[model samples]
Target: DAGVTQSPTHLIKTRGQQVTLRCSPKSGHDTVSWYQQALGQGPQFIFQYYEEEERQRGNFPDRFSGHQFPNYSSELNVNALLLGDSALYLCASSLVQGSNTGELFFGEGSRLTVL
Candidate 1:
């Protein structure tokens, strides 16, 4: 009965540093997607993982990557982080029950502060 969850609710880093964020999908969800939301801007899709593979990716740099585990949990990793990377990292979970338009449940998000 749990919903999607993200760790390190807030993080701080400097340019050139690498950071990893974690997420746990909602109960009965098998698909996990990662998004970045800058202040006053809409969320931008980063990537999505299904069946332990990266099924789709958005217009993000290669430095942004993700992994999905067997338990439907996921991780987002950013290497060589830049000041522009400062944003709220959100994790959304969807059931994908034979349809692609299912509603997505989102976590509170992990806020990243790059200096």
Candidate 2:
């Protein structure tokens, strides 16, 4: 019954550094979506993974990459980080049936601070 879970609740990195954040979806959820939430802003969709493949992506730069494992877990990798990249990285899980994406359950998120 556990919902999505993320690791390294908090982290710090410098500009040009690289970071990877992990996520495990809730039981029975097969799709994972990653988002970036800046201070006082709504969560911005980064990408979505289904069936171990990237199904969609947002406007983020190429520095952002991700992978979905067979177990339905996922990882978000950001290379050449910038100060603007400092934000809460969120992982949301859902069940995808046909063209429908059911309700999303989100994790507490991994906080990244880039200096």
Candidate 3:
């Protein structure tokens, strides 16, 4: 079965620009979450989507948004990006087991460079 996939493995943008990243979840999975990993920091959760709705969000600014489709795929969009927004954007998918003990399968991240 196919695993999580992210698009445009790499991207280059400048300040005040907007970017959109896509993700397709693994087969049989239903939840998709986005994370941002800065150069020297751990991944920071951006938001999560479930059943076509935003189920949870992290400590990110409102400029970050997302969407979930019926097939369990998702997208992350960042507006008015800043140089500091440059990072490895990761997309993770996992089964919605109604608990927090499930495993999250991550895709090769989309590297964004702001110049």
Number of the top candidate by lDDT? 2
Mind giving the per-residue lDDT tens digits that candidate 2 earns over 1-115? 8989999899999999999999999999999999999999999999999999999999999999999999999999999999999999999999997887899999999999999
Q: Residue 38 in candidate 2 has what lDDT? A: 100
| Residue 59 in candidate 1, Cα distance off native in Å | 0.1
Model 2 clash count equals 0
How much RMSD separates candidate 3 from the native structure?
A: 0.9
Off by over 4 Å in 3: 99-101
Candidate 1 lDDT at 81 equals 96
Candidate 3, 1-115: lDDT as tens digits: 9999999899999999999999999999999999999999999999888889988889999999999988888999999999999999999999888656269999999999999
Best by TM-score: 2
Q: What is the C-alpha lDDT of each candidate?
A: 0.94, 0.97, 0.93
Record all residue pairs in model 1 with backbone atoms less than 3 Å apart, i.e. clashing.
none
Model 2, runs deviating above 4 Å: none
Q: Considering lDDT, which of the candidate structures 1 and 3 is the better prediction for this target? A: 1
Instruction: Tell me model 3's lDDT, rounded to 2 decimals.
Output: 0.93
Instruction: Note the clash tally of each candidate.
Output: 0, 0, 0
